[model samples]
Target chain A: MTVQKVWSLFDRSQLYECYECSKCSGSCPVTLAGDFLGPRKILLKCLQHGSGRVIRDPLLWYCTTCQVCQDRCPQEINIPELLTGLRNKAAKIGNIPERVKFTVEKIAKTGRSVLGFKVERERKRYNLPPVVEISKEEISKILAETGFFKDLKIDH
Target chain B: MALRYAFFPGCVIPAKYPHFESATRAIAKVLDMELVDLPFSCCPPTSNMKLVHYDSWLALAARNLCVAEEQELDILTTCTGCVSTLKEANYIMRQKPNRRRKINRILEKAGRHYEGTIEVFHLLDVLYDHIGLEAIEEKCIYDLNMKVASHYGCHLFRPSYIMYPEFLSPSHSYVPTSIDEITEVLGGEPVKYMRRFLCCGYPLGANVDEDASYEILREKLYYIKAAHAELIAVACASCFEQFELGQVMIKKKYKETYKLPTLYISQLIGLAMGIDNETLGLKEHIHKIKKLLPRLQERTGRMRATL
Candidate 1:
């Protein structure tokens, strides 16, 4: 996707509403953790350099989507939502992190994020009722129809 | 009347923390809350799946909602993340007609439809609002006299417009008191601590940037420790895991031992309700909670002597 196409996915008015107040960055847990670029800088960078720069930045993945920045924003800018949109765009171009890819693959295959023999064994050991079987065919159908498999290039 | 809900255990609890499920089940039985099981997929956790493909996440979450709607029951989730994803999907499908239409088209492939009829609830909401504090207090067989630092996980109340529309005027999202109040009712003193509203960094720590995740965890642990909290109580499964396992990771990496035990709110409730530790899965925790057992037993002993 081109920078303009990526930029169009977000609300330009809301993006422009940011006044560089930096409260988002100041209150951001990831920013406070010391290496992240934070919301304020990310918004400024995306506006100036376009979504391409922000999408490719490794720091983009560092956001935990905690929404603290959005909650604290005086402008009510939804930074986490914006980051998610960008990540979706990035994912289309196959720019997702390896670990994220693995997780998505697992979900696609198992209809759940984490599943293994040990989990079943633990359930039995605890005397808990067996977990109901998810319809894997339905899950894959949904993923396929939504282009999740296409975007991530997972084998359906 | 007994409240019935389609129990959404989510992915994490059943796979990694069966104890949370067992504890919730035990408490539900005592409270007359009936949790019905259904074939459900992941809530399509917002941290990654939503980030990967928004529509796919919505479709998957909508499928779960559809299953509940078909059964004519609201969803009751043990995990805060599951509640966030499913509730947000329900909210969006209700607010945006076009998005719903598009997602329904996707769901057609899976033979499912989201009617937006059912609501999603976290276990804390049901216990506090539906079950009521007085009922819970009356049911307690033993006093939970320990000092607790209640960790209200972020997903419980963030994005206040969706999670808590009623409190939009003077948002309680930042300073949620339900867990604290619940703690108080159970006879545990909810200690005041800095960084109580902060994220547990499990989302970041579990998936990406382990170092940064540890940094956030360290910050949260420092404040809880400063308050001299006896244990940390959490409603979200992920937060429970983070507090329990994250401390061990912190100790290994930084050589600093906080040794704070973490308990799910359900387990804590079960303890006060006089449920056995084995049934509550207390021994399964990574952090040995043998210290807490003695403290609880001692309190029960004292109460018995007075009687």
Candidate 2:
């Protein structure tokens, strides 16, 4: 099967460990705002529906990545991490908002995510502190050490 | 003494922000942790994740983790965004062996695989666990009285598996005291705040709602102002950008004002180490944390007077 079929085999089981404690919902900053984004419900969606629905739902992005859900979850579920997975799953299903995609593209091309703010120009705003660049040779050496080349199956 | 791993510097710090890397490097060296700049690419490029084509992002992040695991020393990243992405990919890959295997196969083209051999470490954990505060304290030349507001950023504190143990407190203002202690060692007070540990409006970067985003910053500044924070310090580079830039937006939009600057934990530690302003890149800040420079020296003079 293709990658989609393989990913279909996994979902909510990988997402959280809610014992029905409702702390995730209770502690959620967004939930306090009267949204449907309570951690408990998200967990339930992922657990019951797996990535089938949880991944693509806009309710997923409402998460602030606030550790409140994780902190309050008695099960110690990695809520934000799970949120990321679900978000990733949704994105796979074409659930992404347009602006987010553009941000991602910009980051991929230039290694800087936001568009058009040449840092060299604005360094004065929050005057940059002394920065050290990771030299190409250094990155090459890192690739060699991590066996990163072999693991990624790259020629470099 | 030679520790190496794939380094994912992420978008914020590597290009526009450099002090974070410089300071992390300094602390890593003193702690004897050698960081290697890895050949990994961006973690799905933020908003680029296909609401439609998601595997590409997961696969992309997995490719980076696979490279690190292949290297055998674990992957190390400085940006909160990068750390969260790589760690999450490693988690997903580990959970689904077949998925991990598939991604590994893709990485095989790049000569990497997620065999679960490589782990991920945020620079904070690296410093806390490996370097230890005792080692860091030995290097401090001046104690600080800097009253700071600590922003842990959402990515670092959540997913407690990767974060330190102290952050589980529900009512806790500041998440960790180690950074506060670092400021104290340099004579700056790491002032605690009601919402000191809250989000830094960074999650809004990928999302386009600037007004909604401004609310987050404005909300945060409300507490920062109430707490009388001299400077707001951050561990995450994206957060550093949010505060440094967000304040400018806030000043323009709300017609309210905040002149405080954000400091990288590394930048402050560099100061405590007596590394000097120019060496620490103090001049390039948008809000210019230059005023605090004199305070650092004033503390030094105070110490001399006491002596």
Candidate 3:
């Protein structure tokens, strides 16, 4: 499917509200420290081309989901939310970076993301009660209902 | 009854920083608040799930909230990311009826509903807004003379529009000095450093661009070191991961030495309240608080005189 066609999946016309003020880019930590494209530029591309075209852009994964862009935007466009929509489209097509995919899979299977036995021992040693596990069966049911397993191609 | 909360320790802290949990429990006892544990899953972790599966993110966080609501207690989270996800999810589900109805539908499969009857509080917010600094001060058995650089990780108030609705209106002054205020009350100097608002970059470390993540961490450490802050006091588990682990990553990846001890806000407060190092899980830190220990002891001596 063409990238623009996929943009139809999201109702994100607030993206079109960007006035190109460059305020979001200016305050963007990723833009400052790394070669990742700034928020304003990403918005410009999405508005000009479409969110689908930018799906494979590795720079999209660099955003820390920090709300600096939305906070600094003069137009009040929710830049992070828009970026998340774009990332959701990316994930739909299996374009997510490996680490993010791994974490997602971990959550899908274990009902929690992080994997370590030390925490269980530490909970005991510290006299803190063990973290109550969310029923994985219930989590899987929700994932299935949300189409998460099918979207990510993870077999339940 | 004291202001009790269903404690929601996000995935990172239990696996990475159990000390944060221990110390929070320690101080919650001192402050007369209950940190009760309940059945829960990920606040679904906003970093990854929000990008890949927005519905899953909202539904998972909503499920956790449903559990808290079932108990009729407000949710208290130690992780900023959890706070951001749960608080914003509550706001969206309640404010936008359609989204609420849609999410509640999916949640029904898990035997949950997003009624939005419960509230979420970050431990820092609970300490500052509920317990009050004066009450915290009154319980202090040790004075901290150390200088602390408070990193109020981004998720706490950013997109301040959602997390803090009052900031959206012109009438409200949204200066985020809560961490600094807490530090002052504990008798630690809160240092002003550049990039104070920069993320600790731990969230990004989970991505392929982990180097860039560490670069952000290095920049913050540089400023904190330059300011000669004794330690970076953080209220978020993710920030604690970055400084505690990111410092080691920096040494190995870039061959730079930045030994900045990152203390969870509760650990710092527990120390000020004269909870011993052993009880605070101070030894579990990857970046040793060894250098700061004697200085803390000296402060404790000062605390004794005042008492």
Candidate 4:
């Protein structure tokens, strides 16, 4: 894969247009809830420092990607997209949260988020049809081909 | 075009809240809307999974869309999160050819291609936009004259660029009113409350900080109670869990009481249409609908008799 392909993940030029305005922070649910730094500060960190610093911060995981900051950003900067890119890089370094790792691993291996037994019980209990089964072989191939397994260090 | 939709019941709903799935299907039958289930995986919730692997998220979402496109039918999602992820994916892949080519290149491994022929809608949108409020009014058998609060979860509204076009009107961009209109159509008064657009704190509450997440829910419940809301009607499964179960968690943790019953918008709609409570799974709600259903059933029986 070319460096350009990796760069495309974070290639939002609108991010550079940010003038340190706190409109994003003002509207951020995380910042308002006092759980995480607002989008403005995170973006500022990305501007002054590289994503390396931003990616490692445990606070990055707090963002629900609610998109309020991105919706309210005056500079048209796509903050959520940028945050996702940072998380991607973080995942590559194995800095992901355990809960997220569990979900991603389950999807990668089984092509669904939760275990099948629970769904089976629910299906039988509700008298609904069986849950649709995804072809795990195909999903694994797609994930491997897209370098997603490599990114998450999932064994193929 | 007899109102048929390829139903995308996202992962969580079937596993965690099967009652929601039951109620949605029962209500769809009442409205003469056909819900055909498709073999689809998760919408790959953007809350966390997408944050880690954008390419995987796009490819998975596009693959789901391809299934709906293969059926040559638009998707009708039961969860707000699924609609948001799938709708944004449709918008991006359809509009950007370069990105589409990139995703398709990966999708070829799964033997799927996303031509973007399908559109995505939350059940709320299908009720308000596709079915129309007037038709819903005519079908309504019960007058739920109680004051209800609309919890239009975060995914249904923000990221305006991707979802704004579907808003009721160009001027209605800032405030989406489909759920509110559906409330009135069902004969319930939609109560306005502070921070109506706030996140249910379910994603973060469940994922990152349990305490902070509960605090967010507590704050919303306080405001809803102050607004004199009898119940909180939510369009998202995650939000429903946050309010219904989160209320219990709040009581356990802080000894605070918020007896607000949270219902899926579909559950409430089914109730007003005189669908039996058992079929609608009204009894499955964590905060019991035991007290509220009689009032609705009594009114519905009287209305049907009069009609």
Model 4 chain A TM-score equals 0.86
True contacts kept of each: 0.74, 0.28, 0.77, 0.56
Model 2 Cα lDDT, one tens digit per residue, B1-307: 5667666677667566655666666656555666766556566443344222345556667766665665677777777667766776666677777666666665565555556777777776666666677777666666655788778777665555544434545543225565666666556777777756666655654463455566767878888888899898787877887888889998898888988888888887777776656546777788887777666543333221110
Candidate 1 residue-wise lDDT, A1-156, digit = tens: 112144444676788898888988898888878767888888898889878777877667887778988888888887877888888888877778889889888888888997767887888877899999988888888878877777777777
Give DockQ per model, in order.
0.65, 0.22, 0.62, 0.59
Q: What is the TM-score of chain B alone in each candidate?
A: 0.94, 0.86, 0.92, 0.93
**Candidate 4 CAPRI classification by DockQ:** medium
Order of the predicted models by lDDT, top scorer first:
1, 3, 4, 2
lDDT of 4 by residue, B1-307 (tens): 5699998889888888887888888778767788898888878888877877887888888988998999999999988789989988998898889889998988886788888677888898898888888877777788887789998888987677787664533433356788788888788899999988878788887566878787778888889989999888999888988898888888999899889888888888878877777767776777887777667533433343111
TM-score of chain A of each: 0.90, 0.65, 0.88, 0.86
The per-residue C-alpha lDDT of model 2 at residue A58 equals 72
Task: Tell me the TM-score of each prediction against the true structure.
Answer: 0.95, 0.74, 0.93, 0.93
For residue B1, what is the lDDT in candidate 4?
A: 52
RMSD of 3: 3.1
In terms of docking quality, model 3 is medium
Specify the highest-TM-score model's number: 1
Model 1 chain B: which ten-residue window has the lowest total lDDT? B298-307
Q: Residue B43 of model 1: what lDDT? A: 88
Better of 1 and 2 by TM-score: 1
- Model 2 stretches with alpha carbons more than 4 Å out: A1-26, A29-60, A74-95, A106-156, B2-5, B26-33, B45-54, B69-71, B162-176, B297-307
On DockQ, the candidate that comes out on top is 1
What is the C-alpha interface RMSD of model 3?
2.6
